[model samples]
Target: MVKSVPAWLRILSVVFVALTALILLAPLIVVVGVSVSESQFIAFPPNGLSLRWYSQVLSSNAYLGAGWISIQIALMVTGFATLIGGAAAIAIHRRQLPFSDVLATVFLSPLVLPTIIYAIGMLMFWSSAFGPVSPVTLALSHTIIALPYVVRTTLAVLAESNPYLEEAARTMGANRLQRLWFVVVPQCIPGLAAGAFFAFNISFDEAVLSLFLRGPTLTTLPVQIYGQLEFSPDPSVAAVSTIMIALTIVLIFVIDRMLGLTKFASA
Candidate 1:
C-alpha cells in the first residue's frame, strides 16, 4: 500500500501549487485588467473598468490588416509544418533510412538554435534569393521553427504505438498505402492534431522572425503591437494581447473537446 502524506505536507504542497499558478498567470491577469481600464494610459488594477480599448482595437485598420496577415501566414505555416514534420516523424520512427538518428537530430536542430539567429539567417537568404520579404517568406520561416514541435509530438505518439501493427496489416494482404492509410495514419492523428495546434500558435504569436522580415505592407499582428508599444504606448496593445490570450484558450478548449488532452499530455 502507498503511504499517505502528512497533513502538513499536503497543505504545504497546495500552497506551493497555488503560488506557482499565481506567478504564471499574473502577467496575463495584468494584461486583461489593463485592456478593460477606462484610463488612456495602461495601469494595473485598472482605473475604472471599461472596454473602450478593445473597441478601439476593433476599429483600427492597422490592427485588422496585421491580424489578417498573421492569420494567413499562420495557416500556411501550420499546413506545411504538419505535413512535412508528420512525414519526417513517420520516416524516422520506422528507421527505414540510413542515418535516421542524424536525420532526427537535424529536424530538431531548429529548436536548439535561438530564434534571433534563425531570423537573421532567413532574412539574408530570402533577401538575396527572393529580393524582398513577403508573406511566403514569413510563412516559410515560421514553418522551419514550427517543424520541430510537430516532429516531436508525432514521434512521442509513435513511440508508444505497437511496432507490429503495420507488419500485421501487411500479413493480412494490405498493400503499403492501405496499411499506411488505414493503420498508421489513424495512430498518428492525435499527435498530428497536437502538433498542428502548436504550429499554429507559434506561427501566429512569433514576433522575432516577423520583426526581422516585416515590411510596411507585410506587418503581422505581433509586429504591429510591437510598433505601437515602441512609439505610442496605450491600452490598445493590452487589449490585443488579451484577445490573443482568449483565442488561445478557446483553441485549447476546442482541441480538448475533439481529442482528450490527456492523450497528448501522456505522449
Candidate 2:
C-alpha cells in the first residue's frame, strides 16, 4: 500500500497551498473588484458596486474601434505564427534541417530578448526605411513574439508522439504529404490549438510594441487603455479590463477542455 503523509505535514501542506494561491490570485481578485466598483477612481475595496461603467464602455465608439483593430491584428498573428512555427517544428523533429539547434534558438530568441529593446529596433528600422509604422508593422512584431510559443508547444507535442507513426505510415504506402497531414498533424492538434490561442492572447494583451508602433490610426485596445491610465482613468477603463479578463477565462476553459491544463503547463 502507498504510505500517507502525517496529519501535521498535511496541515502544513494546506497552509503552503493557500499561501501560494493567494500570491498568484491576489492581483486578479483586485482587478475584478475594481472593475465592479461604482467609484470613478480605482480601488481594491470598492465603495459600491454598479454596472454603469460596463454600459458606458459598450457604447463607446473609441473602445469599439480599438477592440476591432486588436482582434484583427491578433487573428493575423495567430495564423502566421502557427503556420511558420508548425513547419519549423516538423522540420526540426525530422532532423532534415541543418543546424537545427541554431535554427531553434534563432526562432525562440524573441522570448529571451526584452520587448522594449525589440520595439526600439523595430521602430527605428521602420522609421528609417518604411517611413511610419502601420498595422502591418504591428502585426509583424506581434507575430515574431507569438511564434516562439507555437514552436515550443508544437515541439512538446511532437516529442510525446510515437516515433514510428510516420515511418509506419510511409511503409503503408502513404506519400510524404499524406503521412504528415493524416498522422503527424492529428497528434499536434492539441498543441497547435493551444499555441494559436496563446498567439491570440499575447497579441491582444501586448502593449510595448503597440505603444512604439502606434499611429493615430493604429492604436490597439491595450495601447488605448494605457493612454487613459497614464492620465486619469474612469470606470469605463475598468469595464474594458473586465471584458479582457472574461475573455481570458473563456480561453482558459477552452484550452483546458481541448487539452488538459497540465499539457499546456508542460509545453
Tens digit of per-residue lDDT, candidate 1, span 1-267: 988998999999999999999999999999999999999788998999888998999999999999999999999999999999999999999998999999999999999999999999999998998899999899999999999999999999899899899999999999989998999989998889989999999999999999999997999999999998899979999999999999899888977886777765665
The TM-score that candidate 2 achieves is 0.91
lDDT agreement of model 2 with the native? 0.91
Q: Give the TM-score (vs. native) of candidate 1.
A: 0.92
Per-model TM against the reference: 0.92, 0.91
After superposition, which runs of candidate 2 have C-alpha atoms over 4 Å from their true positions? 1-13
- C-alpha lDDT of residue 23 in model 1: 100
Q: Per-residue CA lDDT of candidate 2, range 1-267, in tens?
A: 988999999999999999999999887787778878888788769779888888888899889999999999999999999999888888887777789899889989999999999999999999999999889999999999999999988988888999898999999999989998999999888778888999999999999999999999999999999999999887688789889989999999999998899857765
